[model samples]
Target chain A: MIELQHVSFERQGRPILVDVDFEIDRGEFAFLVGPTGSGKSTILRLVIFDVRPTHGVVFVGEYDSQSIRESDIPHLRRRVGVVFQDFKLLRDRTVYENVALALEVTGAKRSGVKRKTLSILSAVDLVHKRDVYPDTLSGGERQRVAIARALVNDPFVLLADEPTANLDPETTDQVMKIFAEVNARGTAVIMATHDLRLVERYGRRILRLDDGRIREDMGLVKQV
Target chain B: MGLLLAFREAFRGFWRTGMVGLISIATIGASLLVLGIFGQVVAGGYALIDRLQERVEVDIYLRDNVHRRRALVLARDIEALPGIAEVNYIDQKAAAQEFQDMFGAGMLRALSQNPLPESLRVRMTPGSDLPQRLQAVSDVANSNKDVESVDVGETWVGALERFVQVITGIGLLLGSVLCLACGFAVSNTAKLMVLAQREAIEIMRLVGATGSTVKLTFLVGGAMQGCAGGFLASMGQSYASDWWTSRVPDLALDPTIDLNFWLVVLGTVLGVVGSWASLNRVLSAVSIK
Candidate 1:
């Protein structure tokens, strides 16, 4: 589960997010929508400790920005999956290597890393491109590799920021389908996007941010 | 497999950022080569200084009324001093012979007696060749019974010792500066390699990869580059030094095997530490969105 209680983040004396509050329960699918500078991405970063709130509490499982130790941040990150809009796959590495990296980095056995990576690659429908490098793959294919990498560790919650931003509609649907499948399988998913097209199509609970505060909460995504 | 994977990633990283890898190795090699050349010059300079210091000797004069047996005993006792390397006793008759050899006979006979006193020609150990050590020996001889005086070429010895000390000081200062320069140069190179692997790092971080695991690959890559640079420099320097010795003839520079070993170790440490520090700083500054 992820929760942000009245979290406000400031940088250089300027407010980025103010009085923002929300919570996503286990196995729930939530969407964070906002225009430029709406603080959608900041909420995801707060959960991951990339940026700390100027005030208030941000919690993901047992980690709270209000109380988490800096040294313990990495361990907190291991239990949470993150996907980037850039499809931050290593250009030089193969599809398999990129996904396997997640497990290998955690010091998983070679056999386990390979098996899990293969399973995730198959689930994302890129099993045929396991050894293909990102540079040679289509943008959507590369994004799927990133997804496979994210889900390889079976994190409790997934935070994805604009994962379908660069993909064509057909590819976007494919990527969104993968996200929905991941959610249905019991991993809490919070996706941030500026693409309202897919937002409406996916029809998940939406938390809309306007001027650094939540203005709309559909499906009561805020959680009572 | 984890460690091996890290090393694999490192080598892959090094290859991917070919230009940065080359530049890092080049700078590291150049710094180490500078250190190697300076070492040779210092070694050669010290050898020359030692040869010059060898000519400075102390003469222990025996008293005019001292018995011949007592004079010889005093000479033996003086030889036992820590700094004294060799002590040759020149009896009055031998002093007379030395004068005859120097001035072509007649000189000692013309004086009607051996005016030159019996002496002990003492050579000091190389390590104890300092002017202060010579002064201490002279003081000891002056305090001995049956010993008339201790005469050392004090002015020349002082100047030579000072000259050697200055050269050694300069060598030490330059060597330390060169080492620091190498460390910085290698660190920057490792930083570049870390930057090149930014995408790989982000991906690793996303999948629950611990910070250490993210850094391990970069460390291995940087360290391997350093080791390669060090090996190249050692080979190049050793070849150049051997050629230098052949040309100089009198200055046979040691093979520098020990220096080579240390350079390789330094290169490895510099690579690991530099990459680790830079990656940690850069990664902490970034977050996956």
Candidate 2:
């Protein structure tokens, strides 16, 4: 479970997220919809412990995010899967190595990591492109590789930042389907997106942000 | 696992920055070689000084027309002194023969009579009090009217001792300064190489990698450069020493100094420390978010 209580963030003397509060329970799928500069990425970063809140407390499961020691950050990170909009993948590495890196950094044994990495790659339908480098992969394949990397560690909660931003409609649907399957399998999913149509089709809880404030928190209707 | 990843990353980095790696190793090797050679010279100089100091003894020349029995009695007394280890009485005839052997066979024969005095050569204990004990011996010998002069290589020994002290002081100062410079240079070179591959570092950190893991990779790379450089430098120094020894023929140099082992240790330690220094600086600048 993730909890954010009156969380605020600042960047270089400018306020970014102003007293924001949100929560996602275990196995609950939710949407974080906001404009380009509405602090959606900041929220995800706070959850992942990459950035600290300026004036609020954060709790991911049982650990206090802001006050936890630096040594414990890696353990906290392992419990959450994060997908960046740019799909940050190592250009020189093959798709398999890029995904395997996530496991390797955590001190996973080689054989076990290889087995788990291959399984995750298969799940994202990227097993066929496992040997291909990021430069040669298409945009959809790159995003899928990023998703597979995130899921490789079997994190309890998945946080995606604009996962389908550059994809075509069909590929966007496919990526969403992957998210839907992951959420259906009992892993809580919090995705930040600008696509209203996809939210309507997925029909889950939606939290909308505007100018560093949460404008809407509502359940979705059936997309008939 | 951490070590393997570090190795893999370091190896990749070394290969990627091909010429830079080679240049770093070459520079490190040359610096270590210079250091190793200086160490050998300083040690050799110290050994030479030790040998000369050990050979120094007090020489008591007997006065002319003094009875040999009275001089023998004085030599016995000198030998019985606390610091004196042994005393050999060189008779006038033996002294003349020694002079002839040293200068040439005819040099002593040219003198109509044996002018050299019978003397007592007194060897001292290994670590006997030098100036005070020498003064004591001189005092004891001077009291006897039969003794004419006491030679302890006065001015020459004093100058040689002072020179040894000066050389040792300068060597320590120079060695410290060179070591500091080597550490700084190696760190800066590693920093530049890290700057080139910073993006890879960021990606690794972004995905739950610890700072130590990243640092270890750079440290390993630096260490490898150090060890390789040290070995090469040691070989070069060994060859140079060997060639010099061959040409000079009589110059004493210990070939079993284990220079290679020492060079490798120095290179490896410097490499690890330098890489750690540079990596810490670079890691501090990165933001995971």
Candidate 3:
């Protein structure tokens, strides 16, 4: 579960996000739809403690983002799985190595990392391409590898930012289906995307943002 | 289990960026090498001073026209002094013979008369108060007005001690500067290596890798480098000592080169500490990313 209350982030005398309040409860799939520069990714960064909120509190599990010590950020991050639009895999490593890295950093034994990596890769339908490097993979496959990596730790909440931005329509549908499956398995998923069509098709809880205000619509919300 | 896992991650990291690891090790080694060489020089200087000290003796010359029996009696009295380790009375005839052997028999024949005075050669104990002992003996001999000079190489000893002190002061300053420079270089190199692994590090941080775990990887990498450098330096020092000592036949003239336990230990500590310093800056600046 993730919660943000009256959170405002500013840098260098300019505002990035203003008084944003949102929560993703346990086992609930949520959508964050916003225009460019609307602070969607900033919100995700705040939840993960990558960047601190200037004016409000952000909580992941029990961690208080605004007041958390520098050392506690890593612990907080371990409990939350994050999928980036860039598919930030180590280019030199294989898909399996990228996924195993999550467990590896947690000080998992080699046997354990291997077991968890293979299972997670299979979950994302990337079992066969486990040994393949990121550069050799297609955009869809790379995103799948990233998903596998995010899921390797079996985090309670998954935050995805434009995961399907570079994927084809068919690949986008596949990736969305994977999110649906992950959500169905009781892992809460909060995705930030501009694709209103996917929102209508999936019909999940939607939180739209325009001019730094939360506009919640259950279904078919019109974008300004 | 924890240690094993840490090492596994370290090796895995080493494999991922083998080149970076090698460069870090090489930097650590080179820094330690410089430290080792300076240490050996100081050690060698001390040994040379010690050898010279063992062979050292002060000559006490008796006044001319003094009775031979009186001079013999004076020698016995001074030889009984508290600080005297050994006393050899080189009588006039013995002194003349020593001069002949040193400068050759033809040189002594060229002189019309033997001008060398009968002298008492004194060797002092290791912890003897050289100035006080020399003064005490000189006073007793001069009291009889039968002593010409009491030579302890007074000015020369003072100069040697001062030279040793200056060398020690300079060694400390240079060693400290070398260590600081090595630390800066190692940290900069580590920073670049961290940059190379920026994404991998982010993922590690996200997955709950403790700050210590990441830090230890770099530290261990640095330690390995230091040890390697130390070993290479030690080997080089061994060869140099052998080659140099073989060339210098007189142990008294040759400097002392020591590879003592504590010196090696100091060099090792410098290498490790330098690495630690570099890693601290590197991990702090890059951990957030």
Best by DockQ: 2
- Model 3, A1-224: lDDT tens digits are 58888888897868888888877789988888888777788888888888888898998888887579988877777778989889888898899988887887777788988999999999888999988899999999999999988888888989899898899999998999999899889999989988878777778889887666676635434433
**Where is model 3 chain A poorest over a 10-residue stretch in terms of lDDT?**
A215-224
Off by over 4 Å in 2: A220-224, B65-86, B103-113, B123-144, B154-158, B247-259
Best by TM-score: 2
- Tens-place lDDT digits, model 2, residues B1-289: 9999988888888877788788888888888777777766666555555555566689999889888799889988887777776888899889888888888878667878888998988877544245566677888898988999988754555565567577667767876776666666668667866876677787777678887888888889888878888888889878877786799755444533677788888888888888877787787776654
Candidate 1, pairs of clashing residues: none
Mark the regions of model 1 whose C-alpha exceeds 4 Å error after superposition.
Answer: A10-15, A34-37, A194-203, A220-224, B1-6, B43-68, B90-121, B136-160, B209-222, B253-257, B269-284
> For candidate 3 chain B, which ten residues in a row score worst on lDDT?
B251-260
Please, what are the lDDT tens digits per residue for candidate 3 over residues B55-170? 65778898787787887788788888877778788878899999988988887788898888988887765332455776777787668677888777545555565676677777
Point out where model 3 deviates above 4 Å.
A217-224, B1-35, B61-84, B88-119, B126-161, B224-243, B249-289
Backbone clashes in candidate 1 total 0
Docking verdict class for candidate 3:
acceptable
- Superposed by TM-score, candidate 1 places the C-alpha of residue B116 at a distance from the truth, in angstroms, of 10
Better of 1 and 2 by lDDT: 2
True-contact fraction for model 2?
0.62
For model 1, how does the per-residue alpha-carbon lDDT over B1-289 read when each residue is reduced to its tens digit?
Answer: 6698789888888887888778888887877777766666666556655665666688989878678778777767767777677878888889888888888886666776668888888887655345777877788788887788888876865665576577678767887886676667666766666677766666666555667776788788878877887887778878887898799877565632477787788777777776766776776754564
DockQ, in order, for the candidates? 0.50, 0.65, 0.42
Steric overlap count per candidate: 0, 0, 1
